[model samples]
Target: MNIFAKTGGNMTNRRDFLTGSAGLAGILFCGCGLPRAAHAAAAAPHRLPVTVAGKHVKTIDVHSHCLFHEANALMGDEAAKLTPPINGAQQAFMTVEDRARAMDAMAVDMEILSVNPFWYGKERDLAAKIVSINNDKLAALVASKPDRFGAFASLTLQDPALAVTELETAMKKQGLGGAAIGDQVAGSEFSDPKFDPVWAKAEELGAVLFIHPEGVPELNKRWAGNGWLLNTIGNPLATTIALNHLIFQGTLDKFPNLKVLAAHGGGYLASYAPRDDHACFVAPSACDPNIKLKKQPTEYLNQLHFDALVFTPEALRHLVAQVGASQIMLGSDCPYPWELHPVDAIMATDSLSDAQKHAILGGNAAKLFGLKGVG
Candidate 1:
């Protein structure tokens, strides 16, 4: 059942749920923020300039990641789960200089750091403690190199009430630009009404909600052996599912202004968004009659934001076509090399104009994060 049914409430006024125009499932190529990300790069021994049409632009990597030693310590044995079989652990715990060097190499001028969640299963007290440690360390890191970093605060989502407070503290006090989250919270999807207060507060504070994925463990057997299918396939799949739930559940309707930035190029949804509009019409039995989306399914794309980590020029071009240049920003998934050349992808999108390229590189993110005076 979609969340609307579970909540047992009728849809709001048509004007409330409906916003934005419909998007075609397929479209033309095109293009598409931030700082604590300037001076440190100028001091680097070797640097890469991310420019569009020979003009420099700030390249903000919104999907970048990090993890903390003290916070992970709280997880004890469970901390091991945060480290994938890959050799990314070193980068996750990278020293400030090392992270700066990595960003320079990736041609990313600024990185908005986030910890892939390990606190979702912890109890309220433990989760709050872990989140507090993570937020404090993240604040310190940004302070240590204010020109090279920004962060999305770690939140204790298992306890929604605490998450609201943590978000407020992080944004209002710690100076975090946003909150990063996994696709699901313990056993609940974000569409569950239990998360309304967090969404409400995020909307009120204008916080950016960056949704990363933790893979689909329920399908572990299907992903067994070779190629890390769980991450390669499951991660995007999980994001796709979470986004759809939010779209159809009227969560987006209820909190229309919440700034949501979906990682991994907003997963598979960016590729097939317009396709979702046809489902309820085609399968009357599968979809709940009582639950209906306010806007056309594809229209929700306008309210959402995405990263440019789809890994190919045409894919990047296609995502821009699907979601619009205003909604995208650079992302390297750095610290691991899913996107070995983020800047090059946009530079190579032959269809993108310089303006589109500049906006995607950093302008959009800078505006969203409330960063001013950035290059």
Candidate 2:
């Protein structure tokens, strides 16, 4: 059924769904002899009902983003380098009714928004201000539409103590769900002992830490060719290095209970994670003699969570096989075209059972974030 059939097939937006689409269809035919109704039907905005196997699903995208002008104000001269997004950046602006319409178009019932860590390299006082504005603004946005949206707090990871306090305040004071952090703080690996306090606080608070990657700046020379290799290769590689350090250097062991969600399907690590298990055996020098890990490197993935933005059905299926269905949740780098049809990708995977599909669509995120009263 055309959802707008009651309106003579003229209704095109949420406004029509709310009140009604009043216009009647035209009888005129095009040069091809097709009725005007055919064009209208074809041009109607796309919507994927958040449902599976005849049951309504509450689809939550664990990976989405937003930006703030207030934070941009803090950038001063650095703001000059910013460019309008060629992809769908308007989604980041997120006015309530407009965002709701956008979410409907994407089949997303809720979006857990994060700010990319552009401020991570800043000094403490400045970084703190930027993060504070972003977190406060994000809280206000969520308050306006609590059911339709959730958010991961921005943190000043450059300063661990401040980051801990920001995480604490965002979760407890402002009612944020968790914190979104970069894969590394400046050039420092997360496994550096200085970050332990922040990770420990997250573990204690049961806050999910969403690790989104900033592009690999160190590879600028080698990635000079086309295809935006900086992001396509660097972002995932950055995540891979971060997770690898966490695994090999014992951060995961130390913070076993931390609910860490990695964007880009845990990057490339989850795709062939068994290679991580063998790295120590293949090269003795890389393994730390004094600090022995309790489990093989790959087993740590069981404790981590990942977004289902791996692109192809085969990739999604393989990611699940590697990490288990429970670990996978929907992730669309929305307002961006990374994975435009996130729900369709889940629906298209023949390898996943309906129950698994249900979990991946929203159940896992709802469970992880302690979301309530969702369909």
Candidate 3:
């Protein structure tokens, strides 16, 4: 009854039936005869069906989140903790078990988990408790399913000394992938002299710091009542602020070994940096005294890592063209509602070669996460 049998086989009704359903037809046709790269053309509207770089290509999602039920139980209702009760919207999508299933459904080999910065805020004491609880939960989750999950620990940047201690435990003791840090630690930017010690510890441990946007505590009110309009502009601006401070103040040059990663496709760093240099043309002093670099601000941006969450074929191509494929990796931002289909987006792009696609999908992340056997 197989429709794909030799040409001499009878054209049975079963052959006609299989060809009608798009999903089944795609699987049968691709599985039987088409070239690997052509598989994406048959994808369903919401699904990601692209050519995997290699056989059984194990995709590693470098960006994802988890919430600790225990942490919420500890804080009283009045506290502004960014856990389960964060907002009706966040609560709707954030579930560890559900996230795991989604990863499995998407054929993700592993997910590098993190806690959002909203949960930690700026309270040192509360941040400490949140860190312990979150780290405990992450460790247990990864340990429970070692093959399917890995995590990056969140540190209380409010206390650098405590952050150092936490990094050792998270990266060395618990076998986490690395650490997650925000754009600013309680309004103090990365270039502030106070952060040198934290960066030093990260450099020594070779930790990967996933930088997310947590806008200044004072600025949240500036965007009033439009259903998280601030999130769109605010998040990207926070990242931009962090990158500018890091570059203009010489944080990147000083802490060359820090494996810092920027979220939301590296914010505005890739697109707007040329104008930055043009503005600096009026004053030579616009460049920081700390940095002795001959290169422009965009050069440092290229040196950092970016996740492929830009959400467009054009944006993806520009990202790759700006930063080499080696610096880009897959990031679905899963369960975020705004999540884009990374595999399909990558496949849709005509600018990248097969080798570049491989790096963006799996190869770069495999190396970053120390994923074995893929090397």
lDDT of 2 at 134: 71
TM-score for model 3? Answer: 0.80
Candidate with better lDDT, 2 vs 3? 2
- Tens-digit per-residue lDDT, 1-375, candidate 2: 111111122222222323421221111100111112221323333255666788888999998776666566678987744433334343234344555666777678899988888887778899888787677656655665678878899998888988898888888776788999889988999999999999999999989999998878888898888888888899899888888899889999999999999999988998788888788789989778987999988999989999998887899989999889999999877666666667777887899999999999999999999988763
Worst 10 residues of 1 by lDDT: 23-32
lDDT of 1: 0.76
Tell how far residue 375 is off in model 2, in angstroms. 6.2
Q: Would you list the rank order by TM-score, best first? A: 2, 1, 3
Q: What overall lDDT goes with each candidate model? A: 0.76, 0.77, 0.66
Give lDDT for model 3: 0.66
In terms of TM-score, how similar is model 2 to the real structure?
0.85
TM of each candidate vs. truth: 0.85, 0.85, 0.80
Query: C-alpha displacement of 77 in model 1, angstroms?
Result: 2.0
User: Model 1: residues >4 Å from true position, as ranges?
Assistant: 1-47, 88-92
lDDT of 3 by residue, 261-367 (tens): 78888887887677766656677686546566546777887779988888778898888878788998878665453443456667577888887877777788778
